[model samples]
Target: MKVRDSFSLNPVGNTSKYTDFINYIDTSSVNAGLLSEVSFLEDEFPSRAQRLVRPGDILYSSVRPNLRHYYLYNDSYEHAVASTGFVLLRNNSSYNTRFAFYYLSTNEVVKYLSNIAELSQSTFPSFSSKDIGKIDLPDIDRKAQDQIVSILSAYDNLIEVNNKRIKVLEQMAENLYKEWFVRFRFPGHEKADFENGIPKGWAYRRADEVIDFNPTLKTGNQTEFTIIPMEALSTNSMVLDSGCFVRQDSISGRRSQNGDTLLAKITPCLENGKTGFVMGMPENEVLGGSTEFVVMRSKALTPHYVYCIARSYYFRQTAILSMNGADGRQRVDEDKLKSTKILQPEKTVLDHFETIVTPIFDGVYQMVQENKNLIQQRDLLLPRLMSGKLEV
Candidate 1:
């Protein structure tokens, strides 16, 4: 059976089910199976928010299929809408929906669709829902489909659990930062001296004075270095995805090392919170990344402090406001970003904060590495099972 016969494409138009507000999902907010939350009032929805997603549907990006911007819509939001950039699929046949999701999400399927998109006339790689609908589906029994889902979901469930733990660890660190810095309730707060409404020895200064933005690095005589693409940075997480090694003479971009924070300066990416805390790299090894990244290193504070500040809402909003250029291509002005005011806590306090949060960040990194392994294991099994090379 073909996908068109197995599922309904872009099923919408139930005006009666419409509500006052909606949870909107765009292609950029999804990667792999993870999704970032975005909401809007019904009247304020974006032009592309045309697909009304159901509970058991799959949302697949039509543009740049190679990026694997897809999600299984099981969110509890009552009035959820997705951008038209996605090809919504609602299963209506006997085939298991989860199985179909995994099948369509295989690297093989993505590469095939990507090839078709690249060969098209569109300026950007893109394809139509019709292209997805014509792909053949395996004629497997429901039991076999359920077995495949069972095996695959085991890996997914473990990954989901680790993700939750990583999120909690991040929150613990961020909350600690808020308690000590934002609320001015650090250790010995009751006895702390105050100057200019801030704890004594703590003063506000330009970000550039305390944090170095796009700090210079010497990469002379290096033959190869690790390269991180913009997509490797997660909008919802501080951990960076593993990047591959490339020759130093080939691609040109920013240079960074361990303990540096890479923040995306581009429009939607900056707004989407695409920031990464550089870690787990080899000692004394410098890395290369997209020029769109602003490499931040500590000049007067701890690396942990710089990372927490970059993750803070105040810093992010300031960066957002500093963006300049064309609508879709706007970038944060490094000068403006450098000029933003930031608090400089006492040296002892900064040291204490780092000592407390280092293990938390380390734990998060370990979990991220584990998830990478799990994903690799699952990906290795996916194509084999889908192609019937490996039996359930």
Candidate 2:
């Protein structure tokens, strides 16, 4: 069906309202739950040129349309503002909102959007609202559309639930670590033999004694800045969504290597507990960082224990407090990171710990790998399910 016939396409903004401004939701606003978390939000443009996205409105991204970021708003997400660039369809009374959503999500429509978009010189090329308006849509009976949407929605529900469960499992691990390691409470707390109540020969020692410092890096040898971009930096999970290719050849300072802890040294990430053990690096001698992470090493310290502790609230608070500089992007200085005290366990205890912790990491690692597989399956099914070709 010709799109102009059944559901007319309308640009989100109106030219008549002299004072109308674009209401682009910022990332902060999205995080605040003011708009659909799935929606692509821009900053609020305060001009009469804006449009108030009502409930049931479908907002499609005008630029980089292939990112497939769009949303069909529910009543709960109504009254938020959006950019004039989003293509808003005024569906006929015969249309099902959910069906229309799935229909628009199809690769068929996306290809149309990409094909007509001016790619001569632009970001991920995209179409203007006019282009979308002029495009044809496959017309199916409304009942059929409803049935299709219900099936696809069921898949969406499963994906969402699995993602949520992954989060809960990680949180559970974190809580357990804190209760046992941080709070120093175990099952045999009351009547157990005690060394100053540190749990039977378990001694508290400074982080310095266990680890004086990491091996010094020669980050200055590079001719241009090189780094593992943040996209390659995964948070709370093992797999990263971004690629590890570097854009630069040389850097002013040294970077990390395989087996090093790729800790995000900057704020928010450091605060958010962003860290991963570097396993595969493109080169052995590339220097780069976001200036937000402090790479730490445990020469004798088990990597698992190190990683586990680094994720704790105790370590994050200590690292954040130990950080220097007045700028928002504060960092834990090399000296401080090396000098900070830590609760050290004996090698005998740690040797015992390695056995127990290895299994836990193995379990966590298995779950992470499973999550990655699940995500891949979901992503692969998304376009197929949405397009109706795979039929749910």
The candidate scoring highest on lDDT is: 1
lDDT tens per residue, model 2, 286-356: 55655455565666577666766777666667777877777876777556655655666556656665666
Candidate 2 lDDT score at position 294? 58
Off by over 4 Å in 1: 14-19, 40-43, 243-251
Determine the backbone clash count of candidate 1.
0
TM-score of each: 0.93, 0.59
TM-score of 1: 0.93
User: lDDT (0-100) at residue 180 of candidate 1?
Assistant: 97
Assess candidate 1 and give its lDDT: 0.87
lDDT by candidate, in order shown: 0.87, 0.58
Candidate 1 — which pairs collide? none
How far is 210's C-alpha from truth in model 1 (Å)?
A: 1.6
lDDT of 2 at 174: 61
User: In model 2, which regions exceed 4 Å deviation?
Assistant: 1-138, 187-228, 232-239, 242-261, 276-292, 322-329, 347-392
